[model samples]
Target chain A: MGKVKIKKKETRIDMTAMSDVTVLLLTFFMLTSTFLQKEPVTVITPPSVSEEKVPDSNLLSILVSPEGKVFLEVLGSKDSTMKSETVRADLLKNMVAEYKKTHPSANLAFTNKEMETFSKLNAFGVPITKMKEWLNLEPDLRDKFLESEQNPGIPINMNEDPNNPNEFQMWVRAAYNSMNPELQESMVKGRGIAIKADQTTPYSVVNVVMDNLQTMKMNKFTLMTALKTSED
Target chain B: MAIKSKSRQKKFDTRIDFTPMVDMNMLLITFFMLCTTMIKSQTLQIALPTNEKVEKEQQNKVKQSEAVTIIIDGKIDEKTGLSNPEDGMLYYYEGMPETDRLAQGESNMEQVEFGDKDGLYPAIRGILMKKNEEVVKRIADLKKEWKEMKFSKDEEKNDSIYQEKAKAIRNDSTLKRPVVIIKATPNASYAHVVSVLDEMQINNISRYQIDRINDVDSAMMIMVKAKNEKK
Candidate 1:
């Protein structure tokens, strides 16, 4: 048999199809997802059958830690006209004015630079007295101090009298009276204010917050919850 | 000889190895998938009564026959100071609190368990469903129609119509619907309170409010707990 010898070919796979699929998947993930915001504490909200989605903008979300610390996160109108930064800057100015009304003798003023920094923050809970000091710290240190056990958050308590408001109440008032009229409207309608607390938090801590809101006459609000998988 | 001088043309393979590109894309996809949050948080809306003290006479009194009070209590873990959702107690009473009968170790307040995981609170569900039977019956009928798309050909239109009809049925004052007042003790887990609130929605109840736990309520609870222990 005078036949030519058979040559073996390299078993190389064409990855073009795989590359195409991965690129499509990456595009989908980029388009369909939102980046997670870093918060001082992580909380697993209780599940409920309510299907109402949390509003994207013009919302004032109050985050309650298991230790009873309260933090506030504000969102402005969805459009670029009234960005969160502008609203937050205005809110800080109003808060300064509010703090002075309660403690008129105390001199508290935030510089333009400090206001800018405050506007960039997604959530804040330090006491108004320590706000300037907290703002002055490096970003990493500020976050550490916020999550630390020693940091007393926003000084909340069961104060029913709205005449002599607490720091937390003052913050609420400031947020309500901010430059964004849309936020004020939603706040009045009960859509703007949302309480996000861990499922394990004692009812008393949440009650204090509710009582405080009641005193302010901002009784209508939303409780943020995760969707329950099993619906009745 | 000139014909024999035709040059041999060399061919080159044009296929590209896309392995490197796919590897880079996979790394990016992993990063994005980890960093992104696809599921948005849901919200439950609630409206608490104003804190302003109204004149007792001006207050619209609830009919004792239609009033149902639910109080949520839970066991707190001493070590962590956290309320265990799994180990929870629910006490409910019909009509007004009978403080006079408490001395005789007899009260209208009855204790109920939150139920085990599989049942998903069958006890409380039964009680609430029994209370809102009229509305529940009507809503169930409407839901059947809604499932069949009897309201309209368009799915969205059918849904809106069903929702509107169900809401009307729930708020129908002609039916006997219980006015539930939900109260939670300080030691109760927040989840328990939410679960109770969720029960209100599931029961098709339109009139319910979250009220503060009062002294009379606590006295009754203590009496009932003592009674339960004795039993």
Candidate 2:
């Protein structure tokens, strides 16, 4: 009789097929899916009805701390590729210069307009002087102008057109002109600004932000919020 | 003869192995999916109405592009036990004519008044849900109606192929969105404050401009007539 021998066969799971399937699905979703981004900071928002979705490109953000300090955060701007930080640095310098002219002995004691003007920040995207107007800083701008001995034009609450006056528009135009050609190609089509504010803040601070945006002639915007609450 | 000998010895396997390439593609896709942001459709668009130099008339007629308002009047106190146990009236301007009326429930609306029997006190036109189970119930009811509305034209197209039994109770002048105007008394609580906004969402009303920012002098207050009313 012939002797019989038993041998074991391998039973390992061939991950190759599974891996291939996973890769196919990943590629499909990658090609078809859109990516949404939140602003770097969080903002508490007041309730409103309009549900306009702002696009991501060519957008800017201006931060308003609860203590009323304004931080300009520009992104995908019409001007310089590196606009916000540059613009912010320039604004602070200009504001300091303007402040020093009048309040020689005093630190910048900027007088803010009423609390309502701040809420407009999400609507308009402009520069510092226009931001001041939206914040309803009639007294501060007026005081600064009076101190510098320059004639103040009528305090126009032109919240719609922040970039209209030549002064605010010129800097923005320069920022756009200075961007690197290759980088500009990536961001040229974008058109929304995102405004992120804390909930406890009065509408006045927000208004100031929007007013500045309008003066800068930046119209489109996105207001950041936490995900909408779902029913249990 | 040498070339033939080489070919005869072995056949070369020319199928380039695709396994590793497929694995790398899957990893790349996973990374992009995690980073992608799905954008939401546009819902709210409000243009800040250019402020007119404060004119003399209390009933100042302002013109706007697609303007809306919220007039809150919550002075009724029937204290309807079925829902919303909050104090005073958190009234919503329902844009209905016959005063706050229910088509079926025990109607105590006529008995509600603001302070000294004038039929006003913060009534039930309010906002979002409250652990105020009643507030949530009302809001849900309102949301149900809004969700039923086919906002897009595609839904309307789908709806065209329907029977009379499938019709919704749409009135010709019923407000799809009521411009809420708050007329609350000075003593109204913060609940009233919340309900004004709540009612706006409940009714799917998006455009809202506070008549007066914060100061409530007679000059600051506004009145908006509800739709389908005989007042």
C-alpha RMSD over true interface residues, each candidate: 0.7, 9.0
Expressed as tens digits, the lDDT of each residue in A99-171 for candidate 2 is 3443467443334332233322222233344445434546455335322323222122334443243332333
Q: What tens-digit string does per-residue lDDT give for candidate 1 at B30-91?
A: 99999998888999999988754541222248788788999999888888877777778999
- Best-matching candidate per TM-score: 1
Give the distance in Å from residue B55's predicted Cα in candidate 1 to where it truly belongs. 9.3
Worst 10 residues of 2 chain A by lDDT: A146-155
Candidate 1 per-residue C-alpha lDDT over A28-147 given as tens digits, one digit per residue, 9 for 90 to 100: 999988889999899999888888999999999999997799999999999998999999999999998998887999879889999999999999999998999999999999999999
Off by over 4 Å in 2: A1-7, A32-40, A44-52, A57-194, A210-232, B1-30, B39-43, B54-156, B159-201, B204-207, B211-231
Assess candidate 2 and give its lDDT: 0.39
Q: Which one is best on lDDT?
A: 1
lDDT, residue A109, candidate 2: 30
Report lDDT (Cα) of residue B76, candidate 1.
80
